[model samples]
Target: MTGLVVPAAARVLSARELRALAEVAERERLGWNANDMSLDEEVLFFLLPYSYEAQPMPLWKCRVIAVSGGLPVEIGEGKRIRFGRLDVSLTTFRRLPVASRKAERQLLHWLAWEAAVASWRSVDEDR
Candidate 1:
């Protein structure tokens, strides 16, 4: 009945990173299994939404490896939590990424700064 949780600091992922992870999930969905994942790979397993309240999400026999931050992580197939290859079977969802309100503000600020810089560069190039 245990569910999985991810903190924001354990890993930082973008939409593009999540999409890359989907590629691995798609492989699992296809019936091919891998033993370990690479840390350099940015994909993470998306846990089942309803299973969050469960004491422990069930574990499937098959295991896969996911690499995050340039290392390998291992995980069972049945759990609802997302994990890197190094974090397999650890049951510590606190490591997952969780952003505080302050963190969100900083993220937004950085995003705006990056956009402005990009636009300025583009304008300068045309001049």
Candidate 2:
């Protein structure tokens, strides 16, 4: 999957921005289905972009990786992994303000619905 450098200032920071960005990208990447994603993924889809604004990370240094079988983000303090600044701590990432709770909740609602639908479809496929 070719990577797109979504500029920090231009990154999806809010629910409105998330929906707008995701809708267009979803169309462009034919197989990239939000319904196939986990709740963690749905959150990270925006959080990854929000990292630039929240982590005080350099926009030029920011990058997003979109590949199947991605690993879970590490959650710990003072557990340096050699290249310290290269990684952004999600613990710190979540502390900053990004979107309104109402908007965030709504986005989550849509994701949860997607998961439910996917499960329903999967049940038939398993038969």
Candidate 3:
């Protein structure tokens, strides 16, 4: 939605989309822009989207997060990648939800505003 235009913005999001966009406006007011959050707090801020036909957050999806995730994780060969205390497989990570619908819709909306500026990150090199 940022780089490319979609054919039509649907009426279905009249409430949802407007609210989410408004929140994007309110990010600084919400302390979302605060730089003092702990590592765990940042982790919690991730994964607030997906799951009617899907998934939660930390329990199942912590791995794929390392891929395309906001933070850096040490990655190496073999099936499992060690991240902190947990070792997770590449297969498991890819299967996890980027967002979980089971989460409050408000949270899902809020997470969309993650402020990190995008830069070129090659997965092979990052890994």
Candidate 3 C-alpha RMSD relative to the actual structure: 17.8
Q: At residue 92, give the lDDT of candidate 1.
A: 32
In candidate 3, which residue ranges exceed 4 Å CA deviation? Answer: 1-34, 41-43, 47-96, 104-127
TM-score of 2: 0.32
Question: What TM-score does model 3 achieve against the real structure?
Answer: 0.20
Score each candidate by Cα lDDT: 0.36, 0.36, 0.27
| Residue-level error in angstroms, candidate 1, position 1 | 36
Sort the candidates on TM-score, descending order.
2, 1, 3
What are the per-residue Cα lDDT tens digits for candidate 1 across 1-127?
6545433332334435444544644643422233333323344332211212222332222223222322232454221222322122224333335444554454445446566877999999999
Candidate 1 backbone overlaps, count: 27
Candidate 2: list runs displaced more than 4 Å: 1-45, 48-97
Error of model 1, residue 56, in angstroms? 23
Model 2 lDDT, residue 97, Cα: 47
Better of 1 and 2 by TM-score: 2
**Candidate 3 has which clashing residue pairs, if any?**
49-99, 49-100, 50-99, 50-100, 50-101, 51-101, 64-93
